[model samples]
Target: MLKEERYSVILDLINKKGILKVSDITDVIDVTEVTVRRDLQDLDQRGLLKRIHGGAQSTHPIKLEKELSHIEKKNLNLDSKIHIAKKIATTICDGDSIFLGPGTTIELVHDYLNVNNVKIVTNSIHVFNGFIDDPRYELILIGGSYRNKTGAFVGSIANDILSRINIDKAFIGVNAINDNTITNSNEDEGMIQTTILNNALEKYIVADSSKLNKRDFYQFYTLDKVTAIITDNNISPENIDKYSKYTKLYF
Candidate 1:
């Protein structure tokens, strides 16, 4: 492909995912890191995108809510989610009641859970399937209405169920985070998450670094509401300082 063609493709990728690694762009555009960096620089100069340490991000910080299918999200930030999930597993102890909110990152957390005799409350179908047959966990499925788009339960019934249950820790996920506030695309999903956080004794927000410094529609909670944030180490030191004052941060 020509330089112009590669530029268009790179821009398109960033627009869809909000962030893209230089290595990821190079592999797709059949170019070297030097070439990708030049493309990103040109785009950055044109005010189309912002260049980061190893990737490019949308110039605009806030993103409107977009409904993404579960399959689409399954692979978007798989590695980062896996790393965050592994660390999250170590923090849970036996016989604790936890709430796993609906999100791709929270679903992955199920894979790393090894603690015995833990009670899990969740509305995510993916999380339900992950441990439906496991004997070690006592799973509580917060059933109500199912939304095929997100493959999760959401509605007043789900909300009421969560209100009655006490949560030791709530692992919540958001579509985006900006200026210490968490937001999501769907109001119903966001409302359910709000209830989970309110009912929990401790709240932990689990998201990949890509979700940081970005915003989605329907603001839910501020960083001060959470106990700590669990994410990948790709987060910048500047951000750590900005958010650490409000809540504990774990990268």
Candidate 2:
């Protein structure tokens, strides 16, 4: 393929997918890894796309949310998630009733939780299972329409259960957080999360650095409404300054 043709194809793919790995480009456009790398570098320099490690993502400030299955996300940024989970666990006090939202990071929080006699509420089957075997926590699983992709229960049934619950602290995960807005890909799940956050005495948004400065399809809640955002220390200084202006951040 000609250089111009390769550039066009690369641009089209990145714009459509929002993010693409070098292998993704090579799969469509017959090219060597070195050539793809060179093209990505050129595009990054021209400001057509943002060149990231082993991949390129569109330059659009807000891209549409893409839902990944729970297993698909389990290993992505595992270290960052572990660090964030450890930090969040420390904030939990003994005998507190807390809501744990659905996400890989949130699931890890259960492992680090050492507090005794805590009531753990969740809409995630994965999260519920994490604490089910342990006698340390009082587990409440909210049942509704189950989303197999995320292992979360959504819809009105879950919302109704959350409304009656008195939660001391609510830790919810999100797809994206840009400026003051917090968003998620699924509307039903977002609705349930919003309800839990609203009913809780303390609301916390749990996410890694990758979730920062992004936007999803459903704008469920905002940063100002939450007690603070718990993220990994890998967040850039610029992002820390920008988000700090909106709400408190714990890294």
TM-score of each: 0.74, 0.76
Write candidate 1's Cα lDDT for 80-199 as tens digits. 888888878988999999988777877877788889999988998888888898999999899989988777899999989887888899998888877657888888888899888998
TM-score of 1: 0.74
State residue 223's C-alpha deviation in candidate 1, in Å. Answer: 0.8
TM-score of 2: 0.76
Ten residues in a row with the worst lDDT in model 2?
58-67
Q: Which residue ranges in model 1 land beyond 4 Å of their true spot? A: 1-61
Cα distance off (Å), candidate 2, residue 30 = 53
- lDDT digits (tens) for residues 7-117 of candidate 2: 999997787556789998989897899999999999899999999999999987456669899989999999999999999999999999999999999999877888899
Off by over 4 Å in 2: 1-61
Q: What is the lDDT of residue 126 in candidate 2?
A: 96
Error of 2 at 214 (Å): 0.8
Error of model 1, residue 178, in angstroms:
0.8
